[model samples]
Target: MTTTTETATHPLEILFQLQDLLLIARKKSEQKDRIPEHLQHVDAAFREISARRAERQERLKAAEARKKALEGEIADVAEKTKKYQGQLPSVKTNREYGALLNEIDGVKREVRAREDEILALEEQIATLKAEQAEVDATFPEEEARFEEQMAGWREEQAILAVDAERAAKRAAELRAGVDKKMLANFDRIAKARGGIAVVKVMMMASHTAACAGCNLRLRPQLLSDVRLSKEMVHCEGCRRILYWDHRADL
Candidate 1:
């Protein structure tokens, strides 16, 4: 069996709870908003690292191809030198022998040139391989770290979502218990006052009173109504709902 005093107190309690819920919701929504930006930065970091790794891999491939081609050229030059050397013993005349000898010298020069080209290519391959190895080794660790951080953030978001859901449910239950007219008034004032629909009056020196929401003087009648705490009251200056602060009396 609820009395008028108890029923009237319900509205204030519900309004307070509603304000709490809204505050918590606002904080959770802000955290949710930050998550997308954080995720974007993480994705960008991964993309940049992946691009660098791909570029390194392409360079390594090119270097390896050059090395293979140089190896083939060296092999071809070696074969030609072998063929020229085998012909040197079969030469029957000095002119033929001299011609063969000159041919051998030309083949040797070609081999030497091929060997130099192969050495340069090998050096390039070594540098490229080193760079590729470094990227490959470092990238996995970086990616793992980023993934771990993202997982933690996701977990936090999940927990916050659960908390927000519970808060929303409690707000809804409390709202249903409140009177329709009072709830509507609260909503209107909250909308007009940027979510500050309710405020407690603060007593001042010299028998004066001020609206806690806007720090404006209240009319004598307004003060009386707030003291009664029977119905909802509003501040004329800020239009915020007002209640008596019993703690101020002590």
Candidate 2:
């Protein structure tokens, strides 16, 4: 990238300004889960109990559905057995009677198996329901224990949401003002460098310049080029865009 006329802002400087807004917005979101130290364990316990109850309820629903299906299967098997037994009076020879008896026995075995499964599913459903009831009875007291602290956490979360929203709006405006090529470069580098693409050259007491991103000493000619700010200069060590520090200490 080339330097602009004296009045125009350097592309890298614009990127630096854009970086500040983006970082602020990201930091605000990162703080969304902040909680009081005293209540952290209580909060975790409450969530754990709630999740346990939810799991129990889900399992109870599945068990009940299985029990209903097993009951229907038992009904179908019983009907088949009754139909086979009704054919016994029509047997004409010993061979015919034996075949009818075998059919009846097979269907009776199926009915017994379905009945056993239904019993097991009913037991599971009852256990899950009991567990759900226990949680329902105890959860309110736990919620009351941390009610005030949780309210404060909620309020702070709301405020953070507002701050993050404002930062997002401003960042969007800044990005819109930036050249697309510069914005793309900034995004690509920031993604590679943990959300920071531009950094000040670290001026040392020993009169050496270092790459702020990497802390590696800049080569003599590279340091000279960074000082001039005539064009975009990437640090040799870190490859992040380098700019002179404009703060008072520098």
Separately for all candidates shown, the number of backbone clashes (residues 3 or more apart, or on different chains) is: 0, 0
Candidate 2 TM-score to native: 0.81
Best by TM-score: 2
Alpha-carbon deviation at 179 in model 1, angstroms: 0.7
lDDT of 1 by residue, 1-250 (tens): 3333432454575687787797687678667557666588887888898988888788878877876887788788789889989888888999999998898889788878877877887888788788878888788799888888789788888888887778778888888888899889988888887777888788886567899889999988889888876777889999888877543443
Which segments of model 2 are wrong by more than 4 Å?
1-8, 34-37, 144-147, 202-209, 216-224, 227-230, 245-250
Clashing pairs in 2: none
- Against the true structure, what is every candidate's RMSD? 12.4, 4.5
Model 2 poorest 10 in a row by lDDT: 1-10
Off by over 4 Å in 1: 1-10, 36-40, 43-145, 246-250
